[model samples]
Target chain A: MPLLKDNDFIDDTWQRLDDGAAIPATGDILVSLARLLADFGKLSNRDGRLGVEFPNEERPGVLESFLPDLSLIALTFPKFADGRAYSQARQLRQLGYDGELRAIGDVLPDQLSFMLETGFDAFEVTERFPEEAWEQAASSISLTYQSAAYQPRRLHVWRLRWARDEGV
Target chain B: MYRYDEFDHRFVSERVAQFRDQAARRLSGELTEDEFKPLRLMNGLYLQLHAYMLRVAIPYGTLSGKQMRKLADVADKYDRGYGHFTTRQNIQYNWIKLEETADLLQELSEVEMHAIQTSGNCIRNVTTDHWAGAAADELADPRPVAELLRQWSTLHPEFSFLPRKFKIAVTGAPNDRAAVKVHDIGLRMHQNDAGERGWEVIVGGGLGRTPLIGYTVREFLPETQLLSYLEAIMRVYNLHGRRDNKYKARIKILVHELGEENFRAEVEAEFARQKELDVEVESRELERISNYFAEPAFETLPRLSTGYEAARAGDPAFAQWVRSNIAAHRKDGYAIVNISLKPEGGIPGDATSEQMRTVADLAERFSVEEIRVSHHQNLVLPHVKLDDLHEVWKVLAANGLASANIGKAGDIIACPGLDYCTLATARSIPIAQTISRRFADLNRQHEIGPLRINISGCINACGHHHVAHIGILGLEKKGVEYYQITLGGSSATDASIGTILGPGFSGDKVPDAIETIVNTYLNLRQGGDDSFLDVVRRLGHQPFKEALYAPA
Candidate 1:
């Protein structure tokens, strides 16, 4: 699996740990929410950066206390059309978590732009689409109607209209 | 009509290009049918029973002459020389090819139109009163707000993938001509005690498998807080709305399950949080949008038009048409002319390219280049001068666009059921056609007075059968087509879901049953002016049920 971050596929550095897996001494690691809750004391005291793979069904408020110590939060899509993760991502960002937010499972190229807008910075990509397709889909719409979590490349049309009206 | 700004133009063009690529990818087998379905649906392309059907949004039911002409051109070039005007105040071309859709959308974009958000689980087109600006009873034009919502909801990042499709309707008048109470979110304009204008926001109202009238979430929402408040509601619905069952996915179900007070509390809490983020469009932007919908220039003229009066006195046919099709405009010498697409025994809302072109020409000549598509599936020239009524009527009569059945029984709303829709269990058009022919006499229709006979092919209720005065729902029971009747429903200011009368009737027997109901109404009513709806409300459905089921 390739990790899509900022329009480029990169090797994933974080080691995903199962519920009963042994904790490494110093490298970055990802664990499920259950594992994080079960081993909170041991995991928080480690030197490595912490990440949690959150389920779509769980509310983002449950992770509020742990967000400060967490470096990354990966939200599950479960299915492409199932959009619970989009809302979860926004809520997570609103809760002031600015870490790497990744989308995993059933991710497609066409949903990349939306994922970006709703605060997903990294995607666990499958071989369902070519690399070029992902890039094209991400940059498909240069403008959006509303302000969102990731708006670096895309500007809101209202702001554009105002700028044009002011001759900027 | 609202013209597209440079940003709007760019956005629509880029979207077309994107969809063009998507379609190419699908054609090349790079995308599966499942993957392409949502994408195409977002662009208003649906695979119907016959071919692809493309629904083009006429925003707030408003269009300019040039836009109408473009629709006619698309119908002639791409479709089978005709298009169906839908109950959502949109137009659907039935014979669209997948390969040609991009080009068609490009052409539409040239006229400041696109089909984005016409379908899919997104904020669908924002509908408003077709008679918004020209109505005598309206307080303000709702189109500016509708257009604002249109721009805000287009490709909205967080809300584009909701549990189900959302519909928002606005009405500026006290009469509720937009059917606001039957939409997912209904905004009714209100003037407070201090004479300050605002919106009465209603949520959770929808007509589908489970029809529910909306509850007033906010008694009065200020004009500036519209976007933030709507964002809050959408956020709540997006997060809390049911996802397990497709049938219970609408916001109405969430509202129903959580109760109105709980839903409102959640929305208000979300709204408070969302308002802190400052996402609402600036007031200046709203003012800028409102400038586009400013009242058309009108000359100071007398209230009475001698020419119109003389024409009416001299010509009975023209007088009859005027009596039925004309509505009082806010301006002294202006009249709103409703051009009925429902002619005698004709397919309701189906208009040919020639008819479309004729309407465009008439709008250019007499109505200040403006036309409206009503939710009842009719065309309206909203600003026609009273003095020019006769000339307009003459042109309309010549072009087969003049039908003296604006609000009569003949003006039926029928969805393309089994004839074109794959989801349909039985045919809706033929049943509507049969009923229309049964009551084809204009005099008898006028005598019955202002009856809405809405027919849907399936339980999805695309034809708005739940809100009709005499609602007919078609079903397939054991491989046989049967029509279920509901009485005393209305989509007006006093909105109520219709109650089912009794057992279903065969397709051939529906007309007779409807005739029996109408005759029963006439027999029970107080006088000529008492309408079929009035009779139904006064006497209830028992009489109608008995009359319908009585032994012949």
Candidate 2:
């Protein structure tokens, strides 16, 4: 139950709203995509900001029109071996959504750095690891073969040694 | 062999450190088995029937004498004193310990070898024709491009979590030594009519339950546009491949469901969209990779070596070995030798540490210190002088490796069945051993002529049974192991899946059934040089089928 963002555990302001619960007046709340789709009219009128949590099967294309109104999008990995969420995260980021991208559920320290490189800026981890663990996982290797999705790309170590995209 | 540069060395070392931490966490109970399984699998460690099996990658199946010796050292030091070569041109140690897996990987890294991506639901090792550079018939060396793809796909940020395991094979020759047609993605280097060289991309060929030959998606992908085109294919597969069922998750299944036209359209669209990504390998970088594959200095000698010819005439066994194992090299006075692991009544592809060191020493002295592991689970000294072959043959014979059964009925390709693999339903090695012993006579094997018998304990096709001349699939029926026979399958330029013969035989009856099929073919044969596959093709499996079920 730790929310790690950018190598640091930060205070989570968003509350996960369950079904049949009264909508809060002015706080950021995360809801399932099914919930948002079913009651978008009633939910959009609330005073609080909106965050959508995508179950593994929900297609991101359905959220095209709702992208502008969202502040946080959580890609859920029900289990560690289920990697449909990784592809889902990359697709969402590719559509020019600059909002906070977080990976929730079944997060392990070993996959933390890969999740980071694939454009997930935040992770809701079940087991808390030391700050040094995250630091080491995030920067274990300085070089990356593919360019990252996040802006100001920090994936390539060869760029530091040579010109950008230049062959050695 | 591509020597690891500083960047590659750092990447492997860092990966080892990372795995060491993960292993420690697993031991300390910080990570459960569920969480640790995929991590271990990605590093090529699998918990099998008895112990942890470590599969190490021999990139494109090319290794130096030094690397081969290091591998022999690992086999002697870590697990048992031997290793099993796999159909993917990899070597697996069957008795690895969980605690020493990371340390063993460190030892492998020191030899420019690591077990990265040998397993797991990711891109497996990139394999090419074992006779890649030395073959006279190939258009170009496939290893440089293969090495480039290996580096690009290693730890690829986006496509690592594919729905299922992916395999890609490349071949520079038109003969298809790498079984390119049965791979998920097959790249064939060909030159167009205008003399412009490029790749002919094939998609969706596989050999599991539903075997299908790959369809050509691109008639000619420019050599420079190779990576971008591959990116296009991977992107399409990642986005659209089936995720609901593990059996239907392979790219081959998606390609099958979409049909070739629709699949080609989608891949072309992705290729067009990513055209501006600038992901193609730079020419200089390609040159750097190609530099490592440059042809070694071969001695210029007469076309016919009197010494080699005299030795062959004097020794009948060595002459038979030469007839079966030696392939013509492009260079004069040089021949490519296939050191068969399938000796009479021995486990196919299993080599002892002493055999490995013998090969290493022979390669250093006679074959320019380069060795290649074939997808058939055979080893090749790609460039050996004709005069020195007698010496090489003597060394191999002393080590019991001069089987002289390459591409013959005795050259069986089999997987580690119930003995070592947890996924097997029956024992395949014993069956293979029995068949090998039955057909142990070299003259008889040569008489049979170019027959390929592949055996798998299950339908997973790890033994490539679906693509063999005589394919055997073992299954369990009511607590008894039953073997099904198939015929007419070929994994070549003309790739086709075999047809299952009616009914199944028990383990004891399987070898006799195969012999009956072979005898039937030999009786109905038209010519002495006609292969078993040729006869099977001319007359359908009905002949072999009727012969198998004949009374008595």
Candidate 3:
């Protein structure tokens, strides 16, 4: 396996799962808790994109040590009841893991823009669903909350700056 | 209210067409759920506990009577004949189906409203003082600037993917009715010694798991460069804001981590780099936006009406309502009336379809066919003639909106918690109802003075419980509902976060705890003039803490 930056078709050591597909485990492939719980620091290699899934908890853990070698991180919504993924996705972006962050598992069409804001790029298009939905979901919204992985210079922040107090 | 100009009209129509295409593709199975989640959220559609919830922007809390009527029609036709107004001056319809969202949006568009950027982590609906242009103490009308920002931030290309959702609030008055301190960016319109109106900019104030009061980043920003300076601050946040941790992703956290000096420097550097873009307000464009907000035609009516005074003296209930709900207007013979949505034991901001229609009709008949929804969850008729107030009161009394509890303790601010919102951990509205019922006596409420009781389902603080004079946060411990009480929070000019008192209580016992806190405040206060917030601020949280946790 090699870094596939050339946009050429190359196979990495990790096994690829289609959208809505159950997580597959291999000694080399990275997996998110969307299907099964896998430890981040304990993972053997960072060559593959690792999936990140959230379970309901009052407070989630911080990602201090895992940012060094993370290649691709995917967030999953087990169900709409669980919004821990929304927080996790933002935490990943804040931790400065400049990698392809994707959203997988029970991710509905309405949440694409919000997922993207917390810094998701690639979405896992499942075999159970049609591919056309992907384009529609991503383009449904034209505005965003802040300037993130995609948009870097936002103007709305200026005009709307009335007497708001953001936390320091 | 801003009617879309050619550019705005074109932009929304195109955006609608784009969404229609996306819906078509989703129907054709081209867009998958994983691929479309962000898209739907950006448009204010959320998958909730029971169904999809659609939040629609009410833009600066201003709407025409026709617009209000259309919203009523939407509620009756699409939703369950009621709509819930949120803390951000938006409305949420809880029962919207995913499939019917596009059609619903089309209906909103027909009424000159849309749910654009209402949800997504994007620039949300711009909010301002509910009293806005009509407030007696306003330095200048802030709506034109808010409208300018609304146009500039809408579908802006570079800022579409922020680390988290961002909110901005503006106010023209020194009283700070908009709670600008709790927003991602807060701007206060100020005038220098030269009488030139500019802005004092603040940033990084938000409420969630972490509650922060925004700090001033700029002492004064010239009105001309307001937009450019804002861009600079945002660009700094965009480049340096944390991306690895969700909790630490809000701009407030970044500002905190970087320190104000460093953050200010970074913004200055970025602003210096972008100076050549010439993003300042164009003279013609500024004039054009301001022209639409020019003062409404005023008749040379008497400043104080003897007729109104006579009526106020005659009707005691009307006098109480006038004292509680009426506000001074910029123009003589005109006053702003705040119609309380927190009617007795009903849901705080929920208005039934018929109530909406009736309010709309009243606005048309008495006011200038205009209504404003305050962030405090009340409707404002901004241009009512003092002489016509009694008649307006009669109409409102006939309708169910005639609650004289505008700024009173019973005028509770509540979020639709577990009963409606999927994000809520416990029920908020029911608790509010319980408290309102417990203190049902208006005489008792008036004696209590101006006390704010805000409730949130979770720490997300949508109900702004963190800043309430008496705050209640609903949390779930195991299978049961637990309520956490906080005291001394205020969102006015003197804003401060509330301090939590001891452990969480069961649902039924929560109201009793509130009663104790209020009684304690009453016992400790020096006089009637001192409000709940003032007494709490003057005397630390010791008395409140003692009263709330006194033995068994």
Candidate 4:
């Protein structure tokens, strides 16, 4: 798997710990919600990037009470048609989670722009796709219609129309 | 009509290019049929029973003469000579090739139209009253609001992959001509105590297998807060709407399960939060859109034209058309003329390229160069002068576009059933054609009075069977087409789902069953003003059901 951030593939240093898997005592690690809850004390004291993996069904409001200290939150796509993760990502942004948001599992190149708009800063992608494919997908539609929750620099047509008139 | 701005044009063209890329990928085997199916569907291409059917959105059912001509060209050049105008106020080409769809969309974009969100589990086209601006009974033109919705919901990021498709309808008038109560979100514009107009938003009403009349969520939503309120509804649905069962996944089911009170509370909470977001299109932007749909220029004339009166007295056929098809317009000397696509015994909304071209030409000449597609599967010339009606009628008569069955039994609304739709179990078009042919006599049609006979091939109710006065639903039993009857449904100001009459009938026997019901209503009527629907309301379903099943 490859980790893509800011339209570029960067070396992934984060380790994913599945349920019942022991968290490594040293480097940055991401753990599922169950694992995090089970070993909350031991993992928080390790001081690497504190990341929590969230299933799509879990409301982002769950983190508003606990995740102020968290460095990253990764949400799962699970399937292409299962878009609960997209809503989750937007809701996470709305809850003022300034931490890096990552989309993992079944996230396709086609959905990268949508993911980007909805506040996913990083993606765990299949290594088969080149970095260029991801970049092209991100820039596929140079402008969009609706303003998204996380995209601070909105490129909606209404804004673009005013910008055009100002430029002329 | 609302013209696409530079940004709108660019957005559509870019979308076209992107779809073209996806089509190429599908051809090259990079995308499987499973993967490509939804992508194609979002662009309004459906794989039906026979071939690919492409549905093109006529935003708010409004189109210019030029766009209608382009639609005619697409039907002539790419499709079989005719196109079906759908009950959503959109057009569908029955026979389309999967490969040609991208190019077809490109052609559509040139006319300020695209197929975006016509299908798929997203917010579909925002339909409005067909007699939007010109109707004498309207307070405001709903098309501009509908157009703003179209822009906002198009390729919407979060709501695109919803659990099930969402529909929104707007009616500017108090009469409910747009069938607002039957959509997922129905917006009715009305005045408040202070005399300021706003929307009375209705939620959760839909008729597929399960019929529901929407309940009001907001009594008076301010006009500027429309987008924020809609976003609140969509976000709530997108987040918590059930994905477990595809059948129970529409926002309606969620609204049903949560109870209307709880649902409205949840929606209000979301709306309170979303109101702070700057995601809504600016009011100035809405005003810019409103300017496009402002009243068109009209020639000064008396309320009644002597020329129209003379023409009506002179030609009985023209008189029949004028009486049934022409409705009072807001402007003096102008009438909103409904051009029935339902010619006697013809496919309910099928119009040939020649007929469409003639409509376009006639609209250019007499109708302020604008036309509207009706949810009743008819075309409307909204601004024709009373003096020019006879001339317009002549052109329409010559082109087979003059059907005087605007609200008559012959003007049946039928979904493309087993003939085209893969989801359909039996045929609806043939049933509609047969019933229409049976009541082809103009005098008999007038005598029986206003009756709406809607037929659906399957339970999906694309034919709006649940909301018809005489609803016929077709089911397949032992490889034979069976028709079930429902009575007394109305999609007007008083919206109610029809009741099931009795046992199912064969395809051949369904027309006679309808005839029997009409005759029963005629015999049971109290007076001349009593409509078929009104009579059914008075007498209930016993007489009609008994007559339908009686010894024949």
Every model's DockQ = 0.65, 0.43, 0.05, 0.62
User: Candidate 1's residue-wise lDDT over B364-427, tens digit each?
Assistant: 9999999999999999999999999999999999999899999899999999999999999999
Task: List where candidate 4 sits over 4 angstroms from the true fold.
Answer: A21-23, A38-41, A152-154, A164-168, B279-281
- What does TM-score give for chain A of every model? 0.95, 0.89, 0.57, 0.88
Candidate 1, A139-161: lDDT as tens digits: 88888777554544688877777
lDDT score of residue B233 within candidate 2: 91
lDDT, residue B304, candidate 2 = 98
Off by over 4 Å in 2: A15-50, A58-69, A148-168, B280-284
Model 1 TM-score (2 dp): 0.98
lDDT, candidate 1, at B484: 95
Candidate scoring better on TM-score of 1 and 2: 1
Q: Chain B TM-score per candidate, please.
A: 0.99, 0.99, 0.98, 0.99
Model 1 chain B: ten consecutive residues of lowest lDDT: B275-284
RMSD in angstroms between candidate 1 and the native structure over all alpha carbons: 1.3
Between the candidate structures 1 and 2, which one is better when assessed by lDDT?
1
| Per-residue lDDT over B1-552 for candidate 4, one digit per residue giving the tens place of the 0 to 100 score | 688778888888988988998888889998788878888999999988788889999998999999999999999878998899999999999889878888899999998999998998889999999999999999899988898888888887788888899999999999999998989999999998899999999999999988999999999999988888998898889888999988899888999999999999989987886634454446766777888887897888899899999999999999999878999999899999999999998999999999999999988999989999999999999999999999999999998889898999999999999988889999999999999999999878877778898999999999999999999999998888899999989899899999999898999988888888888988999887888998888889888877777686
Query: Among these predicted structures, which one has the highest lDDT?
Result: 1
- Descending-TM-score candidate ranking: 1, 4, 2, 3
Once superposed on the true structure, which residue ranges of model 3 sit more than 4 Å away at CA? A1-168, B280-283
lDDT of 4 at B15: 88
Candidate 3: RMSD to truth: 9.6
**Candidate 1, B283: how far from true, in Å?**
1.7
